[model samples]
Target: MAVLKPLGDAEMDERQRRMMDAMLVRGRDYNVFRTMLHHPAAMEAFLGWGSYILSDQNTLSVALRELAILRTGALRRCEYEFLRHAVIARQHGFTDEVLHAIAVGDRTPLTDEMAMVMKAVDELVVEGRIAPDTFERIRSTFGDHTAIDIVWTVGQYSQVCMFLLTAGVEPDPDVADDPLRPLFA
Candidate 1:
């Protein structure tokens, strides 16, 4: 069971009720939201902003965005984020082969643009700084605004991973790992 009890259907206020409805429609009975119910305002703003990014963001398609998100999750070893995004990744056209490769930080077959973005993510996460080469490559490929969006997107998901892990959020039960080892390991 989750350390924090979920907000039961009967317990939610109107705002939470709407968020819960959206979560259910997205097939996410999220343990994070359950825990965050302790601070409903934070949960409301956080989830609302998150929905906007996933649904209304510019600069990247759903597939590319989810790829960056899953990569950040895997790098952080945040099981909740990884598992949730792994499912969404597939829905957004990440083939099993590509998914497995990404789990291990292999960005093979990525477009030049994606590879540069992934390289920036890898450098930022692992080395605490984007390498000069990665910076140049991405800047050249994507221009200023797009490059900023890619980096910020990775940073945003990284923060989500940190929150989910530290807050003791549980992974969705419906998804399963294939080749990658369990993240919590």
Candidate 2:
């Protein structure tokens, strides 16, 4: 179980209550919000912008986006994020083999475009800067705006992983074998 109790749809403060209602009507709950509820204002601001990024406009294909997500999740060893995005990656056409490669942090199976994305993420996590080659490759492949979004997406999820770990949030049950779970266990 999560160290913090998840706020139920009917069991939130008025502001949160409204947000929860909106989320439920969309047939989902923001697990991130449930954890971020301790700071309601931050939660609202984060989710407001986050929803826009994830839903309002994204140019990358779902497969590419989710691959980037999974790669960053694994790099951070964030179980909750990794597990949730694993299924998303699958839904977006990543096979078990590809997901497994990401889980184990292998970059060999990735296509040129995917390799460029993973290389960018690896450089950021390991060195805090994108290498020149990877940057140019990403720029050539995705252009400036999409490249910026991809970096922000990875950074956002990196922050999410940090939050979930520090908050001691439980893994989403739907994905039982998140690669990070073994570390926590």
Q: What RMSD, rounded to one decimal, does every model reach?
A: 2.6, 2.3
lDDT of 1 by residue, 22-107 (tens): 77797777777666776778877887667656765547667778878877887898877877787778777877777766777777
How far residue 93's Cα lies from its native spot in candidate 1, in Å, is: 1.9
Candidate that would win on TM-score: 2
Worst 10 residues of 2 by lDDT: 176-185
Candidate 1 ranges beyond 4 A from true positions = 10-15, 25-27, 176-184
Whole-model lDDT, candidate 2? 0.75
TM-score on alpha carbons, each prediction:
0.83, 0.88
lDDT of each: 0.73, 0.75
Model 2, span 90-119: residue lDDT tens: 677787778878878777888878877887
C-alpha lDDT of residue 121 in model 2: 82
